[model samples]
Target: MAKKKSNVVNLDERKEAKAKASSGNSMMVSIMNMTKRIEELKTEKQKICEMAARTILKALDAKDKYTYGHSMRVTYFSMVLGKELGLNDQEMYDLQLSALFHDIGKIGTPDAVLNKPTRLSDEEFKIMKKHPTESYEILKGFSVFEKVARFAKHHHERYDGRGYPDGLKGEQIPLYSRIILIADTFDAMTSTRVYRKGLPYQTAYDELNEFSGSQFDPELVVKFIRGMKKEQAKKEDKFYIPLMDEMYEKDAA
Candidate 1:
């Protein structure tokens, strides 16, 4: 066989390899910059969606006084109480969303029943009771908030299986639902409806105490009580009574 020429370079090939390595490093830098830019855009998109969602909620608030501020107060209480109970951030987020939507089913209720200055008739109340299920149906379609759907649907359930849409008793109820239930009841009791007056904080606390084990989770109630005590000690945490009264008075007027 005839000798073939060795076309491969020695030092020249090493220099070319070094050049390629530096080019690859530049390409990697470019890729990182692009990745960061994409993340920023994604973050901006999330902010926009969040703003839009809040705007929708605000619009809903304007249409319904009973719903508007009540939802926000429940959300704040639920989230703070959940955090005090040592729930994780994601769980707390779900609790807030659930609390905010717990009364959404009432949107399906007629204004006569929902905004009635007098006590609801049995039939009207029965129709009003369907709100939780209505809320669940409305929210379940949003797969992103499926967890919240359960919370809204079951918040009305009683610890002793007395409360409603479903008769789930005791531990059968989801903890998140149970949490919102406590918050919802607390806010509802402290807030005057068209047919009733707001209870004093002491009265509300006593009511919650009286209802424990039957109406609420005893352990959660204990945590709630402790949280309330701590909150009451803070100057900014004193909104439970005044805020409810003012809002409800406005509603009544």
Candidate 2:
């Protein structure tokens, strides 16, 4: 009887050991599967981000000829202004992104109105005002562009609340939007359109100052103008006419 009991006990011990070994293997397999899934998710996330950015750029390029590549240039200029204005990294990033999509709503505007050789008519002007709302609606699905969409919605909002869409006057409008507003306007003024020649830098600068009180945030306009002057001082040898010509050509095409 004692010998039989010992044999049974040994058998039970073997079973327990086997069970533990099996559990360990299962745990390892589970961990490996989880790790692989995480990697796959990361790859998919990156792909989606790339796709979204590309879609935005393509949409902008198709919106208008002159405005084609202007988003990125405005983004670069806004980043410079954001940095000079003491914005943090995240704030600067937001400004850059907002500037990139500031006119994304123009995607919904008719090409006739967008590319017209003459100024927009009152009826056309009314259509133009819908861009902010249209952009907001179009971008609502994208988490990446949510803040940028908000900025886009309000980029034209005047400091005094006269601007369209939300009309969120002054500080009520996001600071990032404010920065983009100045940057976008500056770039537009300096770049020619179908109906008009580009304003000279000095003339554009003066116009900015002239509109500071009503059209722009007074403090931000100062910062933007200062940054422009500093950039000009650094690139004094470059005529910039070629750059302007290329920019307008890209848009006109």
Candidate 3:
């Protein structure tokens, strides 16, 4: 409590000092100081925003561990493709958030539907399809994730416009959504589950290639495959997640 009060008092003093500095050189220095302080505040705000993001992800993790791990791998794969496509730093950051939250809506799904070992029935599939929109609903509430929510909401939309929620066609879907779908599908295909073994990387790549122009974005699919080949060359069994500040194992874990 005392430290908090002291910080408030220090901020008041700085404001007062700025108001008092009227001389040309003093005013310039005050302006510079204010700019630096503004930058610091922005950094602090971003950290807080990231904390909120991590907290929400923890909720998702607690609800279902498999989904949480899947989300992480999706983010890593999306980032690999993001790099291959030459995404700028800011673009990559937004893509990461989009991938992490893409399946967040699944938390609202029934446990039976989420954890079923076999293929979903037509009725259960309908329930499963609601997740992307649910993801949008949850994430849109956060002011910082406005764009990310939109991206997540459309991650399942197909290139041929046969997907759900909005039925958006090619180039109509957000680019991050396109990139995320590729990653999401890749992880789903390659991640091991209780009912069956995960497909080999080469098999997954072939599936991706076969569906490139229909389910996945044609160009991004190519870039993702190229980037994944480089990832395989590294032979690293783990990948890093920036938001969680932790390392996670690759597929078949």
Candidate 2 lDDT tens digits, 10-33 = 999999999999999999999999
Positional deviation of residue 80's Cα in model 1 after best superposition, in angstroms: 2.5
Provide C-alpha RMSD values for all models, in order: 5.5, 6.3, 10.6
Error of 1 at 98 (Å): 1.2
In model 3, the runs with Cα more than 4 Å from the true position are: 1-35
Error of 3 at 151 (Å): 0.9
How do all the candidates rank in terms of lDDT, highest first?
3, 1, 2
TM-scores, all candidates, are 0.74, 0.74, 0.86
Candidates' C-alpha lDDT = 0.76, 0.74, 0.91
lDDT score, residue 97, model 1? 72
For residues 1-253, write the lDDT of model 3, one tens digit per residue. 9999999999999888877765667879989999999999887877787788677778878888899999999999999999999999899989999998889898799999998988899999999999999999988887778999999999999999998789999999999999999999999899889888899999999999999899989999889999999999999999998877899999756
Q: Weakest 10 consecutive residues, lDDT, candidate 2?
A: 239-248
lDDT for model 1, please.
Answer: 0.76
Candidate with top TM-score is 3
Residue 242 lDDT, candidate 2, scale 0-100: 19
lDDT of 1 at 225: 78
Clashes of each: 0, 2, 0
Estimate the lDDT of model 2. 0.74
